[model samples]
Target: MLTSFYKMHGLGNDFVILDERMGALPLTPDRIAALAHRRRGIGCDQLVTLHAPTVQGADVLVRFFNPDGSEAGACGNASRCVADLVWRCSGNATPVLQTRAGVLPTSRTPDGLITVDMGAPRTHWQDVPLAMAMDTLHLPLPGDPAAASMGNPHATFFVSDFGMVAQGHALEHDPIFPERANIGFARMDGPHHMRLKVHERGAGMTEACGSGACAAVVNAVRRGLAARTCAVELDGGTLRIVWSEQTDHVLMTGSATTAFEGTVDLAAYPS
Candidate 1:
């Protein structure tokens, strides 16, 4: 079947979005991976699928799939992109999205940026699901990285420079993180700003990673290296991340842009 899709991006972390709200589409993991292959298919950092909401107060169900075809618990940038799409279609500035992680509330800021309340950050080793218990604030890793969960596991390495970012691939598969982890290399520019580069699990290095920014900020705060609210500069662009002290929720604000819209025959791709 030919499926209609939207080519969208939050910063430069692009996605191929398929709306399955009206009906279920024949989308297997391999098919999704095929669709995300840069040389062989539509090519995107990730594939997002929208389905009918199954929970109360949610406008839609958002699912994120990595290029490797693994399902991710949450994706901050993708959420903003999906929220923007839903808001434009329903004419609602605020839209709630349900995902594997939980319900997330999103809204459009006065400046035309989309903000997603990414809920509270998780710090427990159990939450990160480490192979064993350890202090999340100062992991035993070489760079003394820290770990946090924004639905999915993340390990942030605060560096004086970006030279150590090359270790991301090895750290991601370390036995300590049983479920694997997104590795973020953060360089503090100041208490209120930082530069970031992430080797996302399954998706490799991307131009931007919203959840990584959130996790990096949360981890930085825990280490007393950054303030609760900070600006994160990624390769694609910058994102304003506010770790609200009152709610303990992380708010990610950024632009979601549509590159184009197109249709593809699922049958033509590997299933």
Candidate 2:
């Protein structure tokens, strides 16, 4: 049977949402890409689906796929959108959504913004899943491989300028990472702030990436270039990331807005 969905965005990090409490639709990468297409589809940066918990005793499961069809561990803006939608559907004040990174807690604020506690950031080499064993904070991108977790995996590189690189270079062809990774560049401004040019896996070059911004800060700080908490400016906008020495997890707070919402004709999507 065909499925129903809605569209939302958090600081230009958009998502196509499906509240599958009863599991009506099977979400796949190709389908996600189809729905995210502006020319032939609804168009979004990410696709979010919420369903009953996969593991017993856990809260609802929130799954996400980038426009490229790859599933991500967590998404800050998308998580907020998911929390708002779940709360609206279930009438629960505080909702939990399980992800690969583990259980994430989200609450609907009076201002209508969804606030999520993104468990923690895994900064070590093993936790960040770097193939080589070494210090994750300072380890240079093997090639295009700059990876860190804002409860998700991201890889970035330092470049003199981003205007020279093509948009969305693939990981498959890059040698630094055996498994393809999200590629981007970091341009430094000072001891506390910098800018990012991201070629997001699955989504290509988005206006901004929330988790990516956090990863960029950690990457710079670990490398002894930037401060823990600073303003990260991206192509789309800016996000403030706080990485406390006391708490390993990165805290990302941003704005989310409900753009228009409508259901797509499933038949119009690709198989």
User: In model 2, what is the error at residue 66, expressed in angstroms?
Assistant: 2.2
How high is each candidate's TM-score?
A: 0.99, 0.84
TM-score of 1: 0.99
Model 2 agreement with the true structure over 1-271: per-residue lDDT tens digits: 4566778887787888887777567556787788878777888888888777977645788888877777887777787777766666679868887887788766665766555767666666666666768665545544433567666667767767775347447542355444455666888898677888777766677777777777888788777778888788887666667777886667666666667766666665666
Off by over 4 Å in 2: 55-59, 87-93, 107-114, 134-146, 167-173
Judging by lDDT against the true structure, name the best candidate: 1
RMSD of each: 0.7, 3.0
* Candidate 1 lDDT, 1-271, residue by residue in tens: 8889999998899999999999998899999999999999999999999999999999999999999899999999999999999987889889999999889999999989999999999999999879998999989989999999999999999888889877878899999999999999999999999999999999889999999999999999999999998999999999999999899999999999999999999999877
For each candidate, how many residue pairs have backbone atoms clashing (under 3 Å)?
Answer: 0, 7
Each model's lDDT comes to 0.94, 0.71
Clashes of 2: 7
Once fitted onto the true fold, the runs of candidate 1 whose alpha carbons sit more than 4 angstroms away are none
